[model samples]
Target: MAKPKFLIKTWGCQMNVLDSDKLAGTLMDLGYEPTPSEDEAEVILLNTCSVREGPENKVFTELGRLRPLKKNKLKVLGVVGCVAQQEKAAIFSRAPYVDLVMGPRSIMHLPELLEQARHQKALEAEFRDDSVLYPGGKISRSHPVKAFVTVMEGCSKKCAYCIVPFTRGREIYRPLESILSETREAVDSGFTEIELLGQNVNCWKDGATKGFADLLEAVSGVEGVKRLRFTTSHPRHFPLEAALLMAERPNICHYLHLPLQSGSTKILKAMRRQYDKEWYLDLVRQIRSRVPDIALSTDVIVGFPGETEEDFLETLEVVREAEYDAIFSFRYSPRPGTPAAKAEPVAGEVARERHQRLLDAQLPIQTRRLKAFAGRTIEVLVEGRSKRGTEWMGRSGDNKVVNFTSTGQPSVNTYLQVTVERAGANSLFGKAVTAKNEAPGAKCKA
Candidate 1:
């Protein structure tokens, strides 16, 4: 008999991606094979993200489309991750067909929960600091080259506009030994890049390792880890040592994703971001001075309660002054159960207008930033083939996507030198340079 098929639709950050991988690993161990087509699966799970309202809505929209698949068959449907934790028992009422609703922590119980879901709906949303054990096993991953290891989970910060603190709960650091063991095992298993993930990765601490910088140093020391990266850092928790480490460590990608919610101190204080515009600018200056070539990216929310025209203009000024290589900008949406939800929102048109202006302000910066790579030779880890057979897709150490046509097969995970021929706002077009002329970092990480 053929094995049952399973499909997972993951939405959100790298943390959710890592969760979906573990979920898939568990299912494959249970004798289910993965199918890319949702229609062909005996089971489907929507591993969701709830950090932003937009992603949360997309999850429901997708579920609505998938609900019809359950009309006449014994199909198992599930919801996992942040949205599952936030919605809890409420998701059952919203979508009665969902069999299992497991939070990120409930991943350890996945095999048992799927077994129990046959008789009745199962819900596991409770937060436990130690519930997520460091998973150690031989399992298939979506990506053969890169992997994400959760160094910690949850956020201790109480930023007023944020719901992560409520959904993921307090910060809980995974034991350092387990993390080192897992990373070493991944290197042994042929993985080269390891991304440490957490809500506020910089805030992680385990016994003597009181800061992310220390943790990063320890992991960077692990042999065979060609590239190391982490994400979603709040400016307040990012210490100077982390900046210094990025400068000194050649393997650590030269990229910083420090979120700057607003440029107006009033709006920032209202959002409880803890750092004012001047403080953020000073930090950026210090970092740039330390690591001049480091690529900078930020998160910006265009509209918030009581944000005046002046406040919006201040944001525009910051975008111009900061000169970010890229940005993830969004029109603010009030999330339920947050303090900002009760506050009067900016008019929709005004918010939309500001959002456009914010994008307009960043266009020149991004254009100029991307153009800087037009004449340079950069090392990229080949991710896979692009739409064109002759073109292969890859990312530079700074995480910029570069597409290049190569004469050779250029297998995934091999590092190749791509001397840029043209640049676009979001990605670069280039031709692969042969081994003789490869850049210093172009050694295939294996």
Candidate 2:
């Protein structure tokens, strides 16, 4: 008989992608082969995100499309991740065909849930006190060169407009030993780049003795780790030591995603971000003082409840001052049950206008910053072929996407020096110069 097949359609951040990998790994362990085709699978899991209203709506639309499949086939249809946790039994009411509704924290009980789903509806949305660590498993990693290791899960920061805490529960830090062990395993499995993942990554701590900076130093010391990175750090939790470590460590990537939700101090307070504009800028200054060439990216929300015209302009002012290489900007959409959801909302048209203005202000700044790389050579980790296919795609240590042409076909996952020929706001274009050797002006730690 042919082996059973499973398909996991994932939506959301890096954390969600990693969750899908764990779910796939679990199913693979249970004798199920992963299939890309929805028609060929015996099990289908929708690993979801409820970070924003848009993604949440997309999940429901996807479920509607899967309704015919669920009705026609004997497939075990499941909804898992943040949306599952948020909706609970409501998912069953919305899409009665779904067989399982499991949350991010409840992933460990997947085997039992799968068994129970075979006969009747299965639900597991309870949050666990302990960390959800996948110690040993064959994870179906999305990227061949890079591996994402979760150092922590969930967010403790209760930002007013955010829904993360409700969906993912409170903070749960993974043990230091478990993190190092996983990093070693990933390196042994030929992954050169390891990205530490979490809801608020820099907030990660191991008991009272160790913190995120310590974790960075430890992971950088791992023998085969060529590059190390972490993401979605909260400004309040980001330590100066982490920035200093990035400057000193050869393997640590010089990239930081410090979110500036609203550049206006008043708006930030309204959002309960904990740090004001002056404080955030001071932190940025400190990081830059240590690593001057480090590339910085940020998340910005244009319009929030009670945001004034002056508040929007303040955000634009901060954007100019910060000089972010890239900005992930969004218009605020209130999630139900959040404090902001009960408050008066900004008009849709006003929000849209502010969002456009914010993007307009950032575009030239981003372009100018990226253009600085031209005529300089940088170290790039070759990821794979680019969408154009004529050039290869890779990323710089600062997390800039570098697409370069090589004289000869360079193998993926190898480090190469690329002389940047030109740059756009979105990416850098270049040609590979040498293999596995440092070039002058390379934006990497000594």
Candidate 3:
């Protein structure tokens, strides 16, 4: 009599990764053991993403591959997260072997769904307004030194190209108290860095008065939190106060991932991004003025419907102007049920060309940004051994990856002062100078 074994194949963003952890924790509570191998598991869950056409298709291909496993063994197969929410009962028709389908909002009903699936096929995609915050449960965190705390869930903005509103439902803010409690718990459990996560993270508001800036200030006050960060902020919701706070607070990481999807105001209007190019660039300027050492990154989607050659060039121009440390660029893929999906699409070859051009334009900008760190000593929170395993790797407060060699092995989760010997486009190569208990006043010193 062995405990049931479960395997989860995850895809998509950091949020999905965290959700997988919660799902694993929940299954563990039900006396199930986790197995990395799919063949050995009694239960297999595909925690999916439907952000683009590519990942959604990958999920189906994986499910088709698992069809043999489901037939050969007495195994329970399920689909969860955005893809499940978007596809709903259609998943069963496409892959009859799927036993359970649950949405992001329906995670709390997992136990009941599992019970129902034992008897018959189960589906739970209902959007529950009250269940915005994840109920307290065991979380098998993926990272030892850093914790991802969900400050909010889902997206409110109805961007023309996005399917997030359809899959994840409207925005819901986690209560302030719950957020603080989780932060405290994470810090107490030895996580020194806390990254607040959400779809439009900077838009988070508590009641009528408090907002993301207030939340940042409160989290920074928490004891033992060495670094604080948040991600995927909407340019429209990002206020100057947040930038001012980042400048004033040493604990808050000087890194912001503000997405500028398009640079041409006309293209942005079609995309319904809510802000024009000037507005976004002004926000960037304001943030940089306040936090001069801040590292900026962005997302760019090329070949949106009706995008002209001028529009793509504008995007390249903005990339040059913004001077991002990194750019996550993608070719536009129409998502079903979104308004943009119904519109005329750019030519496939054209889209592909534009995507490469965008990346090409940003390479030198990124290379120069990283190269500037050379000859400077920066504080890095040692995460673990680098992929090559020759040296240790970690990130600075500005979220640049630093890989350094040391005479003595530096402990994971400890801070080290590393003087950059050289830098590549993607990362800085350095040598650890000292193991420090406390971070200095500034992140980088020349």
RMSD, every candidate, angstroms: 2.7, 3.4, 3.4
Off by over 4 Å in 3: 72-74, 135-137, 435-446
Error of 3 at 90 (Å): 2.9
Cα displacement (Å) at residue 394, model 1: 1.0
Give residue 276's lDDT in candidate 1 (0 to 100).
97
User: After best superposition, candidate 2 residue 416: deviation in angstroms?
Assistant: 1.4
Show the colliding residue pairs in model 1.
Answer: none
Each candidate: what lDDT? 0.82, 0.86, 0.86
Please list the residue runs of candidate 2 whose C-alpha ends up more than 4 Å from where it truly belongs after superposition.
435-446
**Candidate 3 structure, TM-score to reference:** 0.95
Residues 225-334, candidate 1, lDDT per residue (tens digit)?
Answer: 88998887889888889889989998889988989989999999999888999999989899898899989899999889999999998998888888898999888888
| Candidate 2, 244-319: lDDT as tens digits | 9989998898899999999889999999999999999999999999999888999998779999999999899889
Q: What is the per-residue lDDT of model 3 for residues 3-103, given as tens digits with 9 covering 90 to 100?
A: 88999989999989888878887888889999887888988999999998788889889989888887655467899989999997678889887888888
Looking at candidate 1, what is the lDDT of residue 339?
Answer: 88
Tell me the lDDT of candidate 1: 0.82
Q: In candidate 2, where is summed lDDT lowest over 10 consecutive residues?
A: 437-446
